[model samples]
Target: MAKTKEAAMRTKNLRGIVRLSALAGLAVGGLALAQEAPDRGIVHVGGDLYRAHNNAHNTVFLVTSEGIIVSDPINRDFAEWLQGELASMYDVPVRVVAYSHHHWDHASGGEVFADTAEVIGHETMPGALALPSGDTPLSDAAAALDANGNGQIEQSEASGNLAGQFALIDADGNGMLTGAEIARGPVSDVYPPSTVYSDTRTVTLGGKSVELIHVAAAHSPDMTVLRFPDEDAAFFVDIISLKRLPFMDFPGLEDVDSLIGTIQAVEAIDFSIGVGGHGDIGTKQDVADHRGYIEALRDAVAAGIADGQSLEELQASITMDEYSDWGSFNWLPNNIAGMYRILGGGN
Candidate 1:
């Protein structure tokens, strides 16, 4: 009877926590909708180059001569909105769509551009695609997300949602999740990149030199940063988002120190404007802020582990109060959880 009562209490507490989380999400969502659009996302920063923000998860880039080369599309709705924006802003068609990694927020809406432009990413992009098409174990795990045994998983279903449906699968088919798989599930829905590069690739489009730089894992193993040397602008995908909390979605956090070091390593490259996978256009200060934020969270999680705090406790205790004024507080919880796992050596 005591055991039964204890279990019942625990269940009740869990329910309360879920309810609180839902309410908090609603509050944040409301604020996001109410807030005015940032000037950075909509305004043109330089010659024929424009950056636009869709919610808190994607950044769309428009280049006059090259058409459009977006970092991540985030979702169908946002992708549609972006398409319309591009149509209005420029007369040319979108030529290339790029994914920083395989995460849905960064890659899902690639299908929208598939019929138009050539999609490109790291060489692992096709492997990412294979995972979601149910071609691998990770894709199988994601396909198994239909917990209700429903024949079809709709967007509205809990386990059927976009994020739920694309759960990472074991990439190697070795019955074990690799670091890359943990950080970025196989790409789904989006068309696999026609061009995938393991190292660096530089191409000239509309007279602008676009350099694709593959950095060591900070956000995802397949992550790559795009630089427009002539434009004096570089787009770093999920390695960092604007004032938004950093997401540790991939298993790459195990190499957080190296990730930070890699970012600093690129600092010597002269660039005027820096664009992220999420949030608005920024300066070098934004990059420093992200580095500092990740370092602080790493330290906090490490301290929690030393203090004998459970993962659950550590996650609940780590707040984004310091970054509350940042554009996307809604993403903090997930970011915190990712950091906790990385620091606790779970990844």
Candidate 2:
């Protein structure tokens, strides 16, 4: 009963009016929102390894005799909350903040820790986090966004998620957004890493270590997978979910082949347990099953296209009942359509 009520508060916390509309059109939903998950909690994954929760999002941290190594602070509110818990429960401060990727949801609140922690990420993170200078010309898409041709995006000119974030991103409170402000991406408070690495780099803190492996462009170009050998666990985000269907119906997946291969890569890593940015914990076998689901969906969609079936027929025909017991299985239709478009079939 206690757990149930706390979860209700977490759900309520995530249902802000501004957040609801900004994420309304987002693709990562099979249900209403992550608000349905939980408010927050800390779970023990292994010796000295803990998983932090914020509604549907999760991050990991390792506590050692020296200090703590944390990954993906998640967001400002969650980070602040987690920091308070750390201060109360443990004597050590967070010595390192490791990013899984540059996506705002997982990385936004990192600034809270960066004042003291050595934040680190793949070499590409700087590029992902960089805001354009005033003189920087807008991409065709961004330029077109300047509907009034005033070289800036006004509140009225913005729509969708951009409209929702307009007031917040409009620095100087001028009710106007320059190309630089427009480049701030969807979320804010994403502090750039104090340390960046081009290839694999081992972060040793307080006698514990986490190896950041720069992975291929599966989800985000700057994605990193943190391997905690001492803890015998791995932590990742978005690239794969443990035992859950793809988020946002696997939105923007043009290279299904590459993503499946990336899952295979994850399976080969040395870890008994795996924690993702969302959903349940996983293992290598679970990773393999994840690969299987994508492979099955892709093959089904490709075969249907070859057979001249319409997108509706493909969606109707491919139920993926093998994974019917999986979480978010209701999103199978959206997943099917996503593959259909990827295979050069559906609109």
Candidate 3:
């Protein structure tokens, strides 16, 4: 009887423990459900300028009396989200949608604003948009984004490898990859700029003026800096990250000379705060720091080249260990190679 009672007691304890564990699991699940997704909130940077940050990408807008002028919608969902957010907060329509550069990450989803807003970009933007992202053909990209092998590209299949190649196949930003979209062909996330400018275009609206300056080919051939003189703030996308080291040679840094010049020019401007395409708001010091990093890398590469260091030698020997604490330390070798190619013998 004693043994039987002991076994029953152990069983009771086990049941109680199981019950507690189940309750704990439920509690954990509830907490998880309650926890919200990362809020890509619109940060008001004083005056009419506001920043709509989604994921790592940023789109800045100016609340004008006529309507809103936004830059770099990022993607379709983000564009829709921004539209909705604007609708909720303000009664104005989006008047102008501007492309910071021709890069897809910043240039996509402008079609959403096409009907209402005038899409603007640098003159070189159209040619850049027409070019292929890589060597991959349109048909191959379409096949890759076909995901289900259903011979039809549906939105459901927009995951995995398809997501990356979708921009290459989805000619129309209609969320569907149909033969119609494919027939349009030469797929790209970049929409044709309705308004183009060479150097500077000053936009005056709602008692505010936005000075659009074609800074340099720092990030792309047609990188435009949006300067709000009244607010003393400028949005310099892709070229300068406030805190981070930047993504892999700073993503198509073709002209380091132009970059340096652009930085100096921006520093000369009376702006106090700046917004980069892919990071937090930048102080004047952040801009200077970024310029310093670029200068140092250039100097390092120049020194290596002067020492007759080959690509391999430079890759192995050169190091930016001083920037070890920076965002993309792993990209140092790549940065070194890019600098070598640009500054050294490589074309």
Q: Which candidate number has the best TM-score?
A: 2
Candidate 3 lDDT over 32-123, as tens digits, reads 42233445878988788999887778879999988888888786557878999998998889888878887767776676677788888999
Runs of candidate 1 with Cα error greater than 4 angstroms are 1-41, 132-186, 248-252, 265-268, 307-324, 328-338, 345-347
Which tens-of-lDDT digit does each residue in 171-261 have in candidate 1? 3333233334533443433546767888888765576667778777655677777777767887877666657666534344666787788
Error of 3 at 53 (Å): 1.5
Evaluated at residue 325, the lDDT of candidate 1 is 88
Candidate 2 C-alpha lDDT tens digits along 236-287:
8988888889875678678998898777777778998999888789787887
On a 0 to 100 scale, what is the lDDT of residue 66 in model 1? Answer: 53
True-vs-predicted CA distance for residue 136, candidate 2, Å: 6.2
Write the number of the candidate with greater lDDT, choosing between 1 and 3. 3
Q: Using TM-score, rank the candidates from best to worst.
A: 2, 3, 1
Model 1 poorest 10 in a row by lDDT:
160-169
The runs of at least 3 residues in candidate 3 whose Cα sits more than 4 Å from the true structure, single-residue gaps closed, are 1-39, 131-163, 170-187, 308-325, 345-347
2 against 3, candidate with superior TM-score: 2
What are the clashing pairs of model 1?
A: 128-187, 138-169, 138-170, 183-250, 183-251
For all candidates in order, the CA lDDT equals 0.62, 0.79, 0.73
